[model samples]
Target: MPLSAARTALGSATAVALLLALVTAWASGTARRLKSGVLPIPAITFPPGPAAATSSATDFQEPYFPFLEGEVATASVSVGDTSHGFVVNAAQVTQDARLGILPTQLARGLDYGTEALVAMLEHAAAQLYGATKTRLWLGNVGQRGGGDIDFSVSHNSGRDADIAFCYTNWKGEPVDPPSLVPLNGQGQAPKHGLRLDAGRTWIVVKALLVYPRAQVQYLFIAGGLKTQLLAHARDQGESPALIQRAAATLRTPVGSASHNDHMHLRIHCGERDVLGGCTHTGAVHPWSKLYEGAKRLRTASVAATLSHGEAEQRRRALQRLVLLGGSEHRRPMAACLDDPASGVRTAAARAIAVLGGRDDIKPLSARFENEREVEVKIAIIQAIGTLGGAGAGRFLAEAVGQPDREADRLLRALDTVTILRGPALLSVLPDTAAALSRAIRTARLLDAAAGAEPHALDRLGALLADRLLDSDPIDPSRLVQLAAIEAASDSRRLELVPALVGLLQDRDPTVRAQVGRALRMITNFSYGVSWASASPGTRTKGLQRWRAAWRRSRGAPRDAWLITGFKAGGYQVPRLGQKQTWELVRAIAGADHFSVNAQAVLVRLLDHRPPSAQWSKNEACQYWLRWIRARRQRYDLDKPPVETSNACYRPAP
Candidate 1:
């Protein structure tokens, strides 16, 4: 099957899996049990700690020592990135009638979080209800294992939770919202005839700030609501320190939803969790100094352990250093490349890849030469590639040409070369090309014996093709040609149009089909030939028609093909107005094949970095569309605006 069809099938399978999970939950009466309060309220628990005297003595000796202890007692382990991580031993937030907090129907079985996060939410909600008798409506926290959750990007880890904002009627009476309501600039849900209850919202924010268990990283909300809440906090004579923390914590995230409906709360990774591979992205607020200081101390301690511990202990320590991400640990980790245990050596090499500098490359390359373990050798090659420069690229080029290297090693080296593309690799293109051809052939024979799909090998070939397309031309091998065709289609490389047209008459049916797909992606035109089952005559006519379309497209501007089928009727024009150009770009940004190129072009045109690559394509597209529509008056198609946010635009000097 084609790549596009494979993605669709995978999406369908995921949907079916989710549906089955929901059905099982319903059949087991999990939702009904939660609604009826039969499940007991869950309490936060901590592992046993050292005696008070020991803790106090440690604190007196080192001021930062207490922070990790505090974290251990309060925070649960959140392992990995928030968008792609999972929680280890997750804590589930249960409904509490006395506290007037309940998960919405959609969040019933989904309200799992870290112990600190659950405690923080309960504390804030209980404080609010004790004063105002208003209930806090909770949205999705995360799933049981904390992987992907529906309708959210950051809640995959237990650190993120969504809560509905306090709302009120025109008479200033508190309103219990059935669900989230998106508010306008004036703090009013215009369609719903409700206004934001800034005073009550400020109370929740204040309670969250005062909660000592976890430090809040971000309280993402709409800017308009943030203004009203801050103003209300001042009017209520809240402490200056409290107001300052709230001011710094509340944010309006760029390149994402305005977050006018509810606040998305993310907590910092606890110091103890950091040792377990938990990572925190974004800023480290002043209030989080305790945790930050503890992390620095822990890094040194872990490095010490790496030198003296048993093999398993050293491996864990090495892994922790990688997660901590300090360049200073690179030398200590590199020293372990000579460790007796292969696992320790593997972890050390991989750690250096992530945290090492250019100077660390020599140690990795030296280790690769003497390493007898295949796994350790592969890890070193990967590390060299990741720390790419002229030196690293040259090392990879040499590794690729080694005749005694196994097929797996050759393929790994080729993959590295693809990422390290520059003059170093280009200078040896023929050798690198021949190595790639050999690797693919060997991989195919191996896969044929195992009766497995050649997906990984094919993907590697395509990536190499994309990297080598602009280099010195070489006589194309069969697999190289197919890979080039696939890369051109995926990247929307319009400059390859003439070459792709020439491949229409290639002897291989697979080549012809791929060429047809590439032409369709480029021109947005189809001759309706089923390349798989069509007769020879029908296939010839389809190829001929595609060639004709390619000829006609030559008269138009290079990018006109993007807007070819639209009703706007500027197909043959040389230059489109700003509105028409952006409109076409927006349409293509949502296309399957050209979306990546669309993102790159849009980034250049706007003179801003694209949104996080971690975001779903749909999420990124939506952000760009909203950004352009809001600032359409400020920018022209050919020139970027003078003013741009430092957060989203080019960095300041």
Candidate 2:
């Protein structure tokens, strides 16, 4: 055989051997689960727990872990955009494809991504279940410009894609003019237009697993329905290996409603895309390294040609380097500052803006003066803003204060400096208070730039609150204090609240409303009216009530909500190991924040399992609370410690 043919033959054999090994592994797991009396389907459908309420059937179940954090922290590929990544668009809008697109998603340019896996799955359904027998409907992928979508917490990134399950008629014929019709495990729809196509659905799941280039991170499905799919696969004589691999990807997600009718497929990030701030929370599959290696090689090839490549090649390389952010790549990117093509130069500036830090500020500022291209100049300013330190701040302050500066560029400089929040203003101007007052006077700049930095809020509140007291008539910067108070940490609030209560008497309705909201968030007190709609009378009463509470607490800072229910009414619980236990529980429950440590504790407490199979936060909380209370009470003052209390202890349902 020729070399190409021999390579293909080897690939095929490897795939087959891998499949068989997977089947044997899966079969062995199934036998263990069966002997142990673990069920194929969880009994309690509401929240996953061990030994579910009804079913005792056994099948291969994969270990579970949540996706990696970075959902909100990462910047979108586009400036002022929210989504963190980008997807290459696949299919055009086709009227005949049973796909439904949300109008809002379409309007925003979010309804696109790498559609290869989707295209393959669609093809597999048609081939396996007969032509025109099923239609794969799609929901939102990332929004256009890949930022935060209004309805999802994690879809701010491009890796996640929501596709509705395949629907068919009772006779296994495609629903005429295919549309999504959610069905239960009996393959029966709540309303009678269509039924679930189990075989076709299995084919879709199998295709995702076997698709050479596709690395599906998680396939969110309802637990009861997943049980049906696995059974269907087994009954259809699917090779044990293929079924096992497919089973590994399917899961019933916790912290959300059961994904009964649809599947949320989150693929891993592209190996080549350089995500500076983006993070992957899911388990890293071994195959992902292959994609990453290939992508790195491609990017390296492009970066290598930056000095000597064609204009288009250099521009492409510049864009790639921007996504693949690194200090090491900055030198080549800096060289692009002098590129003959204006577009390439602009791209180089933007890339450098993100990658360059304090050291690059001086060169960037010098370039800003001589660079004649308006776009490239703007890019340089942006780079300087991102490279923020005293030097960058001084440059920005000078630019904004320049008498000849254009209004728009000056405003842009003002906003950038506010975001950078270094000694920039102070280094050039008189003091910290003076710098903050200048930024706050810019009108709406304070609100626009607030909350990006937690510490910024602290400085704004402290400086501006004092400034407010000094001004006789009212200070315009008072709004800055109000906005800052809303975003301030509990520690900042401790220092600012006593002073802020006086603002309730301010004549400005906006200031009063903002202050009210901040007070409400910081404390549970709301004086018989919503601040958003509060009247002058309401504000007076609310302020009076807050004052009384402040005095009652003897001027101590109000407590954070996370500690409200603890024994001493603070986060610091008194008892042997109890403080740590409360923190662990809070972390596990993720009441207000995400913590890997908390998740790990929850996993261990739940017996080395990820939250699935009828596991709800309420159930987990109740179980832990009961265990804690029981252990706490286990010892009377005379009794010894409760040795019987294990981490996996559960209360009776």
Query: What is the C-alpha local distance difference test score of each model?
Result: 0.56, 0.44
TM-score between model 2 and native:
0.46
lDDT of 1 at 564: 54
Global CA lDDT of candidate 1, please? Answer: 0.56
**RMSD of model 1 against the true structure:** 16.1
Q: Stretches of candidate 1 above 4 Å error?
A: 1-75, 79-86, 98-109, 168-175, 184-195, 252-255, 273-290, 401-653
Instruction: Report the Cα lDDT for residue 60, model 2.
Output: 12
Model 1, position 240: C-alpha lDDT score: 93
Candidate 2 C-alpha error for residue 43, in Å: 55
Q: Which RMSD values do the candidates have, in order?
A: 16.1, 21.0
Name the best candidate (by lDDT).
1
